[model samples]
Target: MQRVVSNLCNLLCSHYEITLISCYKANETLPATYNFPTNVKIIYFNEIYPDFKLDSFWDKVKFSYRINQLLPNGSKNILIVNNLLYPFFKKKNTIYIRLFHNSFENAYKKYLYKKPLFPPRIALFDKLIVLSSKELNHWQKLHKNIEVIPNFLPSIPKESSPLQSKIVLSVGRMDKGDQKGFFRLVDIWEIVQKDSRFGEWKLHIVGDGLLKEQIEEKIKAKNLQDSIILKPFTNQIEQEYLQASIYAMTSLFEGLPMVLVESASFGLPQISFDINTGPSDIIENEKSGFLIPDGDLEGYAEKLKALMQNQNLRESMGKRAKEIAQEKFSKEAILLKWQKMFNN
Candidate 1:
């Protein structure tokens, strides 16, 4: 969503002087040449040195002071916050929009306060932007200004080559084994490999993880390296989607992944383990993609193998996936929604 937000802000700047602020320290770095347009000014909030991990009252006091110091200098600035440094620094003219990526009521009630990184001031924004109707409804009961604007997709590439292989791809950080269902996917793959139903179709795992070495060990022990390809993370993810015929997701949960939107942009039909809150909103079951019951290992394999055996089914669903993404999640569509909200 960073790229989408950046691009949308740039588009908005044709009519307004927009400054993009980054509050969190980079979890990882991007190449410097990955540039935004020249008109856009990028500023990180670390100049005031907010204490990232507050272990004591002193740290919280210092952090609050630092945030007050770092609050932008203009009275009229539209402070679009991703649920950080909110309610701490109030400006009468500042239009604070809470971009709630996750932490819907279920997630908030279950995990927010327990996690060190959960934003404590989530309730103080002028308005909240969520991804789904379910989340908007959940927040609207407590807060009045909640809106649902789903994640945006970039324009589709002009040319898409025909699928050359029966490759099923799963993309995510492999670090949280259960979160992305990497371990469960591997276990299901193990069962599918031994069965005659899968034949020579391959499962390609993309993206890096903390469990890389352990996952490699498991693959080696199973003697399935020949049938499975494990790739490190890459910015050039479109290449994988272009080459593969299907996108497979086994996420136990999500905040509506941009990858699913991007996969649909590539016209790749998906086979996902439908857990709470994301896939059903995006997939539309067998129409655009196939969704298995939450964590149903047998169902995951059965559906994956079924799609693998039928090339016609893959093409039919993939076309539908692309169409849905183009209509609902395109960048222009989302920006128009934002434009109306900001102007109103």
Candidate 2:
């Protein structure tokens, strides 16, 4: 979300007066992890609660109400509330847009809709921006005002992968509290390495989260240390894409996996479970990559092995993947949609 926000702000700031409002940031200096345009204004909400959190019900209520007082331009312009879909966070008569970075069904199934008043509170927003059409279909039934505007690609690489590397790259957060469902990778990789033909192949997972240690334990237990390599996140993710032959995503759910699009830009054949909203939107199935039936470990392993065994197939699919990403998810194409929405 930070990367997408940073990218959007950097571009949109040129056309509009963009002010980034961050709730948890304590100091004025923005985090070095993300860059911003010089002209964009930034509002940090931690003047009072420097270490804000919702550990208690009182804290939740406090944070919600106090936020109203701190918000800039209380009664003018558009307000986009991302991830937090609370009625209390909205302003009176302001053009509000709620951005859901996850699928509507899973979000409701998990927690947000369980609040009893939550479902009805969908009416509060003038518009809702979902990451994919899957959520668009589900959300439109409840609220008529919804848009399926995906995240724009941050950058396109000039160099594409040669597809000669024996590496299958996976990148995503695997925090202990995350729903990324990375444990499934362990089971899938275990099955994948059993084939003696691909003993030299490696699954290189590049990400950082609290679950890294626990996942490392599982990898150690399987005694497949030589087959799977875990690396920390890097700023040079495009280099990682260029070095890999295939991209694998086993996300339990996603809004839209930008990583898949990023991987595609570097001409890597992709593999992902047919999860809602994200993967299907970017991947062209057998052409760009393969989509295993959701949660089908056996099926996922089979397709991954097939990609591993054939360099020609990987190159063919990867070429198509790059074409789709370069055409569909271009920054101008996506921002044009936003420009129209804002103008309308």
Candidate 3:
């Protein structure tokens, strides 16, 4: 969420005066990670409602009401909301643009179906933004105003990462193990490690989460401590990408995954499950990477093993991956799309 906001702010700030409004507290400890333009102004809702609990329903309602009151009563001001909470603020004069960062199915569950309060409020928005054509199609069935704009690679690597190590990399927050399918990856790694063809290759899982201890336990139980490395989140993630030969994702579902885009920019051949939205959008099957059938652990292991054994195939796919990422998801191309949207 921060990446999308920061990237858009960085791109659009030159032409417009941008004000970023947040519902959370801005303290010294939780400093701004992104470098915002000098023209951009950031406003935190906690200043008005200091006791706001992000998880509490009543607090969210109060926050929404405050936000609605804060917005200028004129169409000249454009409001782009990158969260489900946009439905709560039904301002009359402003242009409300919703930037949905999840698959339509997930969005349906999170914003519309589960929370009955949102469907009617959803109609209040002027435009809805989706990540893929699949999501756009799905959302169009329910709403009239929608657009498809994919997430872009923030910056392409200057040169492709050399495939020197036999490493298969997977990155995501481990706290929500079910969502990211981290447990599933551990099981898949067990199968991959057992295969003689991939004996030397290691599975490197990156990012921290609530299930860190449980994940560690599973790795130890399987005696995969040596073969499977669990790494804490790091700012120097690009270095990790450069050292890896292959990228893997077992996510049950996703918004258009930024990790896949970053990995592809490094020219790493990817192998991911054919989830609802993301992997298919990024990877070209058997070209840039392999897309295994969803929940097909055996197939995933086999594909991983095949890639690990064949250096030539990995190199060829990695080259294609870099080319596709650069051509399709360049920052300039994506920024232009946003610029057009803003103009419209």
Candidate 4:
């Protein structure tokens, strides 16, 4: 989410007057990760409504009222949300856009159908942006104004970094239980560790969340403390990607995981479960990497073991992955898509 927002801010800042509004309080300690252009302005919801609690229905109403008051009362202004479906502002001048970062099935379950078939207020929006062609078709059934714009690779070294560490990398927030399928990776790692060919390789899990303690306990119970390393989130995450030999994801579902795109750009062979949406769009199965069936832990381990044992195969796949990322997901391509969307 940070990568997508930062990338847009960086790309559009020079061309447009961008104002970023966050729904939460700004972190005081950490400096801005992305260098925002001089024209970009950032505002936090907490700064505007300091006592507003997002969990409270009344507070949300008050926040919406406050937002309506602040925004210009004309159609010239554009309001883009990550995925949240807000109530219609009723002002004719403000255009509302919902940029979906997950599957339409999930978004429908979240916003449209609470009970029976409640009509979504989505008609209020001027446009909708989806991550894949599959999502575009699904959402087209519901609305006419939609476009497919895949996520782009963030700035990373184009050359393949020397694989100095025998490490398998997986990154995501641990708090998302079934969505991330992080616990499933712990089980898969245990199976991989049992194989002598992969005994020397270590699994590095990155990011922290509410489930961190539970994941730590599971690692201890499985006696994978040495083999499986859990690290907190870091700004220097690109270095972690460069050091690792392969990338792995066990997500149950995704829109289009930016991490996979970023990892592939660094020339890392990726192994991820073939879930509903994201991985299949990025990985060329058995070419750039392997995309095993969703929830097939044994198959995932076997493919991962194959990559671990064959250095030549890993390098070949990594090189192809880098080429695909560079050719298809360059910043220039993505920026053009967004510029067209805004202009249209």
- Evaluated with lDDT, which candidate comes out highest? 3
Q: Return model 1's CA RMSD, one decimal.
A: 3.5
Higher-scoring candidate on lDDT, 1 or 2 = 2
**Model 1 has how many clashing residue pairs?**
0
Q: How close is candidate 4 to the true structure, as a TM-score?
A: 0.85
What tens digits encode model 3's per-residue C-alpha lDDT throughout 1-344? Answer: 77677777887787777888877754453326676666888888777677766577876667667777877665467888876365466677568888888787875756565678666666767898888877866777557988788888767988777887988899999865367898999999999888776778888999898999999999999999999999999999998999999999999989899899899999999999998898888899999999999999999989988888888989999998988888878878887787788778
- 124 Cα displacement, candidate 1 (Å): 2.0
**How far out, in Å, is residue 309 in model 1?**
1.6
Per-residue lDDT over 151-191 for candidate 4, one digit per residue giving the tens place of the 0 to 100 score: 78655475675655799999989875557888999999999
Q: How many residue pairs of model 2 clash at the backbone?
A: 0
All candidates: TM-score:
0.85, 0.87, 0.89, 0.85
Whole-structure CA lDDT of model 2: 0.82
Local distance difference test, per candidate?
A: 0.74, 0.82, 0.83, 0.81
lDDT of 2 by residue, 229-341 (tens): 99999989888898899999998888788889899999899999998768999999899999999989999999999999999999999999999888888887888889999
Give the clash count for model 4. 4
What TM-score would candidate 1 get against the native? 0.85
Instruction: Provide the global lDDT of candidate 4 against the true structure.
Output: 0.81
For candidate 1, lDDT tens digit of each residue in 1-344? 56656656656777777777665547445314444667877766664455465666566556545655545675566667663344555655667777767747545755455864444455566788888776765677557887788877657665452555878888998775457878778888887898866758788999787887778888888887887789989988888889898888988788887788788888888888776677777797998889898868998888888777888888888888888888888877877887788787
